[model samples]
Target: MKNAPTATNSQSTKNNQLEQSQYNTESLTDLSTAAQRARVLHYLQNHRALTTLEARHLLNVMHPAARVMELRDHGYKIITNWRQDSDSAGRLHRVAEYVLMAGGDA
Candidate 1:
């Protein structure tokens, strides 16, 4: 038999995640474009990887690529990898996944 998680375990997990998110929000001042750009970089720095859809869903930004361009302009070497994937409906599309390089001189 497979081990299953109980309801109490799930609630505690959600509470912990909520507390972590609250702490993360304290540093965000406003929802300006520059702030959004910083958030994108911060996420890339912390998570080390991000996709266009993830940025759109999480940061509420329409153009994550533009934010990536701004980061690059500021001397952040972000690498973009194009991936072909199929959506839930079976429609295929190309997506850009970004990663911040360790040494961002280029």
Candidate 2:
């Protein structure tokens, strides 16, 4: 499932194409937080718009609070959007969903 290059001039974009072409997504959803972060961006060069918990669980990251900040310092727009875990139950919210900022794109 490769898309024609999006007209970018960065190796990161190429790397994303390479990774997406070579990964077994069946096992991807189960990676550690840091690993997940690395993997997500690795496969897409998208490094922002991540959720706090998603960043934590998927990447196996211990200090996302700091890491996200650092990444922001470098130029990333992180967003926090929540989804309900269970519908019409009592009231519990699933962690927020994340997407990479366009800037990180190559």
Candidate 3:
């Protein structure tokens, strides 16, 4: 009987969950968009190029194009190349791959 959760324990659990949710939301929102874009830019500067999937997988960025545009607006010289790739099923598709140019903070 002691192992069972009482009404007070249930209310406390709900309160704890709400607090945790608020904390998580605040922490996530505290990461500014500029910081996210900078992560993408740094990856490009070091790795030379990045694709949309690579950006999502490596940097946890949902929209790489948006980040690229932000970097470009900040005066970063970035270039895009359309790459033709085949998937495991032999389906062909085009992907926009981004590369930092030689000039402008490269």
- Per-residue C-alpha lDDT of model 1 across residues 1-106, encoded as one tens digit per residue: 0133456565455334433443465344546556667678768878888888778767666789987886675567899999976655777779899998887522
| Candidate that scores best on TM-score | 1
**Candidate 2 global TM-score:** 0.39
- lDDT for predicted candidate 2 compared with the true structure: 0.47
Which candidate ranks first by lDDT, i.e. highest?
1
Per-candidate total of colliding backbone pairs:
0, 9, 0
Q: What is the lDDT of residue 64 in candidate 1?
A: 90
Clashing pairs in 2: 32-58, 32-59, 32-60, 33-58, 33-59, 33-60, 34-59, 34-60, 49-99
Higher-ranked by lDDT: 1 or 3:
1
* Cα lDDT listed for each candidate: 0.68, 0.47, 0.66
TM per prediction: 0.63, 0.39, 0.61
Q: Could you give candidate 3's per-residue lDDT for residues 42-101 as a string of tens digits?
A: 678788898876776567677889878866754668989999865557777787899998
Per-candidate RMSD vs. true structure?
16.0, 9.2, 15.7
Supply the global lDDT for candidate 3. Answer: 0.66
